[model samples]
Target: MDIKSPLPFETSDKAHANLFNRMVNTLVENDNVLSQQIEGITNETLFILKGDQAIQDGSVSGEEYPIGITFMDIGQANDTGYPTRYGFVKNEKISNFRFVQYYYGTGNEAGNYFDSTGIWCRHWWTGSGWTDWHKLSGFLHTNIGTTGKQLLTKAEYQKVLFNRKIKDSHNNFDIKNNRFICPENGMYSVNAGVYIESFQRYANFELSIYLNGIRYKNIAHHRQRPESPSDTGILNTGLYGAANVPANKGDYLEIYIYANYEGDVSRYVSDKSGWFNYFDIMEIGGRNFPRV
Candidate 1:
């Protein structure tokens, strides 16, 4: 990328007026690229202008840089121009770089194993760095009951699997406390799955995310279904849902369920490790806006 000189302008004094006027002509240059024209001046009213916004791609001005596969920061340009760099975004402020791409890789001490989950990126402090794998919190598990005959009260709502089972990776969730306390303030993606089964009467349940003692995201609900009068326990239903929510530090995240039935109901639970149920949490971006 070719970076044009962003000359400093000074017009108050005769010595600085000539140099300032010459730099002003470059401001309106038709070259393509988003330009940040800021000059270091002692005056209170500082003028920082941007070039044409409708600039097209592949323009020489560097306005509207295209980011496809990967990108990185290299910092400010020099006097002659931008220095040659590889893979990274040249002649730009590293502070402005937003998205960071990541690739999936897996290996164990016993054997080398890898499966393609595709490339993913985050606007947060995420990257392809190996250590970033554990930086984000995520988990998966199911809410199964103790006895098949005792669950989902006929007229009442019951928290599935005794609040929530610690199935997948705990991440930021406190297994003992049975709640996910956010470690940072930002936007996050949450998902859940529920399984309902009835031995005799139809199955009925309501799943949701109870945040800060207040019911937040509603996942799934089974109103009424065919009942096995002979108590065969064959009728079953699966509920899955996902949603995005804004959260702040100290906010609590917990899975809740209200099951109602006549005979028996259970939502697939397991005491052993490695449950099929899934509950995932990912931080996307933070709240940042221009202060006008």
Candidate 2:
């Protein structure tokens, strides 16, 4: 059988002829024709098998996975730009992509891991580098040392969870009745007259109560309060806003109310009663209150 040379033919030099002759002589002397054929067949078979396996595994050649990108800061860009030295995957489709920044630092100076704060991605290709691209500001992460705005207090959260109400002694008025009615879950109300001394500062506030641990399923907002005193009125409105509240049995309720306040009130209020004068609880359609 005639053996074909693996090396390309080059007429430029006599060294090529010497190398070809040496290869042919070696093949004949060693009787390597069958071995070479088997080796070639095995490699071809393996290549085909591996190619199928790679396709199944979502592997692509000349593709850069976003996981390979590294971020040095926590700053986020809104429809801004890409980070330095980061590029998109070539010849690939992307969806439901997001970028988030992780905060890492101790004291005054904190660094971010990436740009944006939530999952965001776009189908893109990078032949050279990330340039002249459009990226929306997804989310922003604050450094761990940066003071987070007050979200909610344990007691306030509990009050919303328990759906407690404040009653006026003079009228025996179930002030809880006057506040917002959590239609599906139950009713959660607080008196406008009560004050949490610890959270003295104020800003636009939003109260989110999870009934049965549904999570952000039901949220209430009370915007633009003046100070502690203003929060009282806002709380009252939040409780009695005529909105359908979340209700469920064996449900864990987590209430997160974001507010601009001065200090941490976690240690301040012990229970729902600390923030309100009259603490009462009642189901929206039910008459009796659970004995506590």
| Number of the predicted model whose TM-score against the real structure is largest | 1
Candidate 1, residues 78-176: lDDT per residue as tens digits?
321211111122122233345333322122213311111112223322232111212222222223222232244556554444334343322456656
lDDT of each: 0.45, 0.32
Q: How badly does each model clash, as a count of residue pairs?
A: 8, 25
After TM-score superposition, what is the CA distance of residue 117 in candidate 1 from its true location, in Å?
22
lDDT of 2 at 220: 46
Please give the range of 10 consecutive residues that has the lowest summed lDDT in model 2.
139-148
Candidate 2 structure quality by residue, lDDT tens digits, 1-292: 4555455445768798779768777776566667576666643343322222222212132243333233232223232232222222112223213322222221221243332122222333345332222223322211101011222443344233223422322122223322222222223332121222233334344444444444443344544444445323423222211233334323333333443443333322223342432223333331112338
Lowest summed lDDT window (length 10), candidate 1: 79-88
